[model samples]
Target: MTTTVRWHSIPELVRDAAERFGDAEAVVDGDTRLTFAELADQVRRTAGAFASAGVGPGDRVALWAPNSAEWMVAAFGLLTAGGVLVPVNTRFRDEEAHDIVVRSGAKALLVQNGFLDREFTGPPGVPVIDLKSDGRHGFLGSGDPLERKVGEDDLADIIFTSGTTGRPKGVMTTHGQTLRLYEEWCDLAQLRAGDRYLIVNPFFHIFGYKAGLVASLIRGATVLPLAVFDVDRVLELVEKERVTVLPGPPTLYHSLLEAGGGRDLSSLRVAVTGSADIPVELVRRITTELPFRHLMTGYGLTEAGTVTASRPGDPYEAVATTVGRPCEGFELRVADDGEVLVRGYGVMRGYLDDPAATAAAIDPDGWLHTGDLGELDAEGRLRIVGRKKDMFIVGGFNAYPAEIEGFLMRHPAVAQAAVIGVPDARLGQVGKAFVVPRAEVSEAELIAWAKERMAGFKVPCHVEFRTELPLNATGKVMKDRLS
Candidate 1:
């Protein structure tokens, strides 16, 4: 007898890809290569291991590991075993990781004992699965494979927020909703069968996990997981593997430019970037220097995968300045207060076990109140102004840190910049800038230069330079950490 499966879950999709593209390369990690068929076999074996440990349907399993062949296996294994996957950020400290375990009530933690010179065992009582080693040889595989059915509405994953703002909230996502988003996401990204995708974004992030891996299987693309973001390593992989699709944040592009001298990067064809406004100069450089035939930018939040994406061959300035129009099955609207509201299949089920927070985020009508602020032009292009919380008032005039940061990026020497409001007795609040300079540039010079270009209220009154701005796993500036 067969279990009646209604929706094609992650496992089901992987199995389909294996059947359709059996001999095709599915994953490329270091010296290891896995075809779709082989990848499916490993997933089943890993699922058996989890099943042997009694991790069944609806059970919470925390995954605190980096990107690797084994990370992919464990994720599929847990989901295939009918367990809810909770991805924990590898950067999380012991206490931070412990807090998620307590909140999610994860019964099992699949953690790596050897990463960044740390060992995360978990908070006791919860069983732990250790997946640490150069290869999948150390992963679980001694038990018989388990076959289970996962419905569309079944819980797939619980991803905790980076906690840059207040406490980290767990966002719940389902298999059906996630796959639906990436079906359209794959189209926007122009991901296709046989294409090689280099995923430098951490697996813990929705961008890497769902948008990275899940999208790949949907289109039958080869997955190349980059455990960490190293410029040299990325360039080497791009050249060696002939990666066709490369998507990342603006900083990633900048880093590529820095490391991109005399490299045969002609293999790159489709380049997708977002998470922040990319500088016009940077976009020009990418278009001219890189061999990407289709370059695009998109906008979304943790609640959704990708709502808006620029079409292929969009004007360089347009692609650089604005995130493109909304994808199919999603609606975008700016609230009266300028907050961006998205309603669609991509919206998360809700915050994990946080009804109050979920209610506040997604209203009765289902419009997920994205805390971001944006404007849709007549042409339907979106320009993300800033986050609702990132907007600071100076002498009654509103100042958006993104706008200032965008302008700051124009400076040849500025590598990155973040602006935050500080208490000011006279003006109520003043803009404070945290900058990462590419070269030797003094804070006084930057402030003076900014003062000349921007209005008094918008110009950063305080400037500080650092080797790098505090960033979360997703390359977003941790503004809360700045102060």
Candidate 2:
């Protein structure tokens, strides 16, 4: 049945879910489990406290925490109270968090005391509320009347992209946009009341915030939240909780496979991996090693939301090859130059207050110019080639590093690979590969493998073997550092 609540407002959905599935398990963390009724009540109380603290509509309330029940409650509370939510990356250093808070103009900040040996400090000048305070849980004991007047156009969140090249810009998403995107995802993934989901992705990320928390709540499903990525812990939770849906990036899945070893994972039914492409060999290993029947992949950006995802029933090749088709209400196109573009309700209003960058990103025709290059097949599936900005010219021919990396990953000995363009006096710029081998593969062997598969220019001119590749918080390889 289709939900009728206004897409822009979240409290309405919370009210409905609580009424419909009050007794169903809503959130689970270790020994902590909160039913829909309990979760909704807590959200109401949290919203009330925030309101009492002078937080109002359009005001930004920053949440700097890991994946936990409190994070979910704070997020919902802020939205229910008509306050904009700004989720800070848990991996952000002190200076980064300070800059984000100042840039977003958040008046209130909710943060965990510490996690994984990292301490989080609230943005200076903003009132800091401790999520772990014993008294913090008591704030949900009483009701505070909510002043819910948020409109479809009202800003709901400001998600900061990892600033690899420069300062991170906050992508402004509206309530209507996020709600609509979740609705589409639920329909596409066939999420229902009985579904049990395992959330390992950080809540600070749009992928986890939208797909894991918001989608589960709206669909009447159960969410199992984890504070950090622990493969063994994840396996235990999946089996114990009977988790039906598993959504994470390729690295998470790879780790899970490694940790599984000989463990039984029969309870897991669908494994959804994305955020970045997965190696074909890894896909094969998951199918052969795990009890999961359906392995899917999804594609999205912080600005456009999750627009493409392979369904559970898709073929193995489709799951490994493409990032599926456009999600409901979203349209995908390949520009003449091969850049991917999307137009949908999920697209952000624009980068917060940065008109020049916004203009460069979203064209006047309403299409969001995804900087990623890709190709659309006859079946409409999108195969991401690489980032547009990451492309480099080699002897007058455009060289996409992701293509080279994808090919290299097929080699049996290559564990991970990243390609970057380095200055060459002869070819203007030649590709250099930084590789991490699984065991002890030599650079000469890998180069021969690439030469056998790719063109001479596409193959690496020089190779460097390292124990590990540098990555950002999101697990994406940092090519800039390699150069």
Candidate 3:
């Protein structure tokens, strides 16, 4: 059956959850806790205050803050007022932050005092509203409830995708599309009511915002937000809150294995991880050593929330190997050039204010060119090969960097690795490895290790060691910098 939803907009979706799970713990952030019923009430009030402040339907409001309970209230508050939310990366430099706020034409901004301990001084080109101020709460909403119903196509949020070469593009998503995709994601991932979720992913990212908070609301799970990702803090929260579901990047799980010794990790029942360079060895250790009952991985991008996910009962090898079949209403097919293309509700409507780029991304036929290269098997599972741009030709053979990076990670000394194609005189092009070592390991040894495991074409001729690979806030290695 195709994906379907009863709620038309985000406010309605939240209202349904609040009514069904009234009085249940909806959110927990350190000392601040709110039940579903109370949370719903606050949302209406916040919306009323926004309305009082002149925010109306279709207005764009910027929210620049780290993960906190207030962030949740502010986000839903904007939606409740029929305003579109524009989330800013908490780690963005002042210049980057200014560009997004100005480019999106944000009417007002809800900003924190400081992010990562650095205060944002000077003009931000918009009316900046302090998050900790009474301004958000002092003004009272009309006593009348404002749960205005909206259509499925109503603009919910405009999330900017960070591009390396140029300015970020705002990807537009509607309320109905997001709700439907997560409904499939939650159902396939077995997210249930009463499950304690420890969300370490940043809220600005779709994984944390939709998959973390919105999914919890839909499934009636308790959300425990982590402002910062500290290994010790994650362990402490997991133990204290009895977190049952934790989904994060591979680095999160890697740290857990390294530092989680002797901790009460038995409460961890579900673990979800995904990336192009996921190693089978990591998946093996997670299943064998970790106490998680279900280990799954998924594949998605900023344009699409979660297009595919591994099933709960999938074989451990398959779970580690592929990013499972497409979610309902989503169709995945590889292009002749080996690029992955998908068409579904989860795909963003368009790139805001950039029709030429949108036309390039989503063809007239409606297939969204994903730029990712992958292969789908007869059983419908998809094995992500690598980025189409990252594939290198070695001695006339096409060698995907992800395949080689995964092989290099199997080495005991290698903790993280990224491979980029560098120009070569003899082979026309060759692979170079930028590696983050687990310990003091020589590049010579790592190159020798890769030679033994992978084919000659896939082996990196050059290896460079980094103390820590340059990563964006969302944990993806900045391959452009390496190149």
Candidate 4:
């Protein structure tokens, strides 16, 4: 699914969207509703503000804020002013956020003041712009849009993903790659014009920033940004605003399923979710019970934009078991060691200012060595087995936590499950399961059930019940925390 390059830069897309979808709702944040033209107008003014603040081409600016209309304007505004966007995780503590700011060499910081009760004033001499208050008063400068020498090949954002070396590495991506990737994502995910998109995923993630906001801009969809993910609040918004598109991890849908029984969610027509192992029964329930006309699961990482995704009319079995075939412009292959490798237009240019690391990640041949383990079927569809680093050896047999977690989810009592290898004197390493159960079930019963259903080595040696598992902003279990 190679796509024709539409508008070259992010600024161009903002202008084009306004021209094409003028007077249409572009964003809905609480009582504030902005039309496409209005949003573009604010973006330009905000860009002018940034320009006045000494930001220029190639300069980096860290945006540490929660999801909101202001966050949207601030991001496009920074890009329009020719500044590289470095979105900091909202969940990060003071030190974490500041580390990215200092490492990215951000010229300025846009902090959501009073958010989470912490003031995010950057290091001395760096200006901090409060996104909420400044947008209305001092930050929204009244001037014509600044003429920035921005191009498709110019760096647009430096998103920091967790690195294997303990420090976060900034993944650099150009405007052209971002636009083209999400354009295909919109096509595969069935995001169309006039759809109201609820962006529950944090804006720091690639899926939230690119797939959520950029895809909406490409398709003229109205964005409804949620800073927080409250199941009841999400349900109310879906019913009240008639939200048509909802994309998140599998856990989001599961929460909705549990809480949205009586709620009117008929407006939700498109859903795309992935990130963790999905229970086949859950997929069946979503398709059968939910009002979504399209439900898809995909596999992607921060290093690559969306790699592969199930289509709208794919069989339930495929949708449940596999993350589907390679998306347009991406080529995928499995290595002999079971690691998934991808080469694509959507691959990041490199880690920021780290040539040695970049060379190691992307070989001379251009294949990005994905640390994930997967098996390609006869039709070239991929079924992700586990992460290469996450695989643990149980005695002599290799045990994948994701594979075991899937089997555990099949149990009727289990709502969520996570498995981590624990050292054992006898087996060398055994599985310890953490379960969030929907029904009362004893640990002995679950262990007994697992022993009958799976190989002895595969069965968990220990089970611990919990009300909820630790989830990151993207809804993936924080397995590191579990360990």
Instruction: Pick the TM-score winner.
Output: 4
Q: How many angstroms is residue 375 displaced in model 1 relative to the true structure, after the best TM-score fit?
A: 1.0
The best candidate by lDDT is 4
State, as a TM-score between 0 and 1, how close model 4 is to the true structure.
Answer: 0.97
TM-score, predicted candidate 1 vs. hidden true structure: 0.95
lDDT comparing candidate 3 with the true structure: 0.85
Error of 3 at 352 (Å): 0.5
- Clash pairs for candidate 4: 1-328
What is each predicted model's overall lDDT from 0 to 1? 0.85, 0.81, 0.85, 0.89
What C-alpha lDDT does candidate 4 achieve relative to the native structure? 0.89
Q: In candidate 3, how many clashes are counted?
A: 0
What is the per-residue lDDT of model 4 for residues 38-123, given as tens digits with 9 covering 90 to 100? 99988888888888888889999999999999999889988999999999988888788888899899999988888878787787
Using TM-score as the yardstick, the better of models 1 and 3 is 3
Where model 3 places Cα greater than 4 Å from the true spot, the runs are 121-125, 134-145
* Candidate 2 TM-score, true structure as reference: 0.94
| lDDT tens digits by residue: candidate 3, 1-483 | 865587888898788889999999999987788999888888888887788777889899888888887888888878988999999888888888888888788888877775577776324456777676643355333334565556789999999997664789999999999889888788877889999999988889998999998999889999998878899999999999999999898888888988989999999998888888788888888888888888879999989879898987888778989999888888999999889999987899898899999999999889999989999887999999998877889989999988888898888888888899999999999999998888888878887877888889889999998878887777778888897
Residue-pair clashes per candidate = 0, 0, 0, 1
Error of 2 at 212 (Å): 0.8
Query: Model 3 compared with the native: what TM-score?
Result: 0.96
| TM-score of each model, paired residue for residue | 0.95, 0.94, 0.96, 0.97
